[model samples]
Target: MHLTRTWTPPGAYDLPGSLAVLARGPYDPTFQVHAGSVWRTTRLRSGPATLRLTPAASRVRAEAWGAGAQEVLDGLPALLGEGDAPEEFVPRHRVVAESHRRHPGLRLTRTGRVLESLVPAILEQKITSIEAYRSWRHLVRKFGEPAPGPHPSLHVVPEPRTWVRIPSWEWHRANVDSKRSDAIVRAAGRSSRMEEAAAMALPAALARLQAIPGVGPWTAAEALQRSNGDPDAVTVGDLHLPRTVGYALTGERNTDDAGMLALLEPYRGQRHRAARLLTLTGLHPPRRRPRRQPGDITRL
Candidate 1:
């Protein structure tokens, strides 16, 4: 079944910038950018679907195919960030204010599919993005079915049961360590409860996610930011975000998570949005050490 919709946002909307966070990497099998439209494949509760979004003047054109096509179209508004209230976010810092002014079209996207975000967030735990992206691409392409759309290369993300059934060796082949793989399997086992978190309050949703072993504040926050379009789901434990937010706000190169939170205290209900704007400023403290290279676990 093919479905289509045209959505006009209440305010400015950045199609590429808003959806950029959902793409794991350039080679992600479930996401793509071709011919001025963004293509994404996902497994909905009803079934798998492929969605293509094209931005036109003052509106976005959305098209979908497969059993979940109607469901995808129904949620198009929320998926494109119609639920986010960016105007209420008052940027306290100059850097944040400038970024907000510069990127008026930027809005947080809410896919409302917890497992879609949770699995990827779990894979990214304590690993280089290169490693995480590589593993996700390998696993999905190897296990997932072809997307039901014109884009032949695009593939839908695997269902929770499929994720749970991936053997140990395949994960190792994808360079995924036992810990992350185990977490994915556990999360998949509880996929129903996890998906329910999408409709819960942010704090409750976060707690629900963290109830799974190996999932923590960072992972929970990362998942909800996309799944719920939570403006205040501040990622508390990241390798570089604290430094980036701190330096951007206070010119402090040594600020930790606590200090970063303090700096963002003014934007209590929109801390994540504030941090996002800060990062968009392209300000980062000078690196004091060599960049961490992606690890090769397949050799292990």
Candidate 2:
């Protein structure tokens, strides 16, 4: 459906800003799009939208198209950023400020809740990205809703109830093992609690997620990275992050998680921000390993 909405000034500022940071697609699946399963593309759509401020004559207009547009746009500030942090949240302040300085048009977003972010993060565990994304596309398209507006081709994430009911055969088809699938099911069982965490303080939110089965430090951190924009919430058990960060910062080409943490010590609460910098600086260390191509699971 074609709809229209208006944002006076500050209210809508967070919406468009979020789209920029979360739209990197394949480069950052944790934030960009919500996955239903292993083989679908879901995007957030917006109604007729515009932004204007009282002090200036210039106006900015926006239009988000596709499925999940409302969910994403409505939930951006909640998932990708925070509006209530104190000025003394020094790490966040510095990170946001630095981000502003370096990327003037940058828009931080909140990715909604732990459930949506965590499911994919878990799927990504102990596997290559191609594996993770394939699993996501498969699961989502099989279970998710059609896009809400004019863009029926898009899909919204499956509801928690829907996630809890997925069949074992389907999971196997997507290359999802019982461990990750169980974790997703458990999280979905308490989906309401996860949604409640969005209104909580960062630490409290992290604690809530940890209480769920199979969601530990790494998964929580990954979820919070998008849902809360918490600069200090570093992924403790990521398979590839430590080496990537280490090589980018020290040129040593390898390091453990502890070493990566130590190297990022100066950034403290802004570890994610430091990582984002290393990512955008375009300084990837030369690859020493063979590249893996994606397997076509659909024909299996």
- What TM-score goes with each of the models? 0.99, 0.73
- The lowest-lDDT stretch of 10 consecutive residues in candidate 2 is 48-57
Residues 14-124 of candidate 1: C-alpha lDDT, one tens digit per residue: 899999999999989998988899999888878889999999898999999999999999999999999888999887877888999999999999999999999999999
> What's the lDDT for all of these models?
0.93, 0.59
Most lDDT-accurate candidate? 1
Model 1 stretches with alpha carbons more than 4 Å out: none
Prediction-by-prediction clash tally = 0, 27
Please list the Cα RMSD from the true structure of every candidate, rounded to 1 decimal place.
Answer: 0.8, 6.6
The per-residue C-alpha lDDT of model 2 at residue 222 equals 79
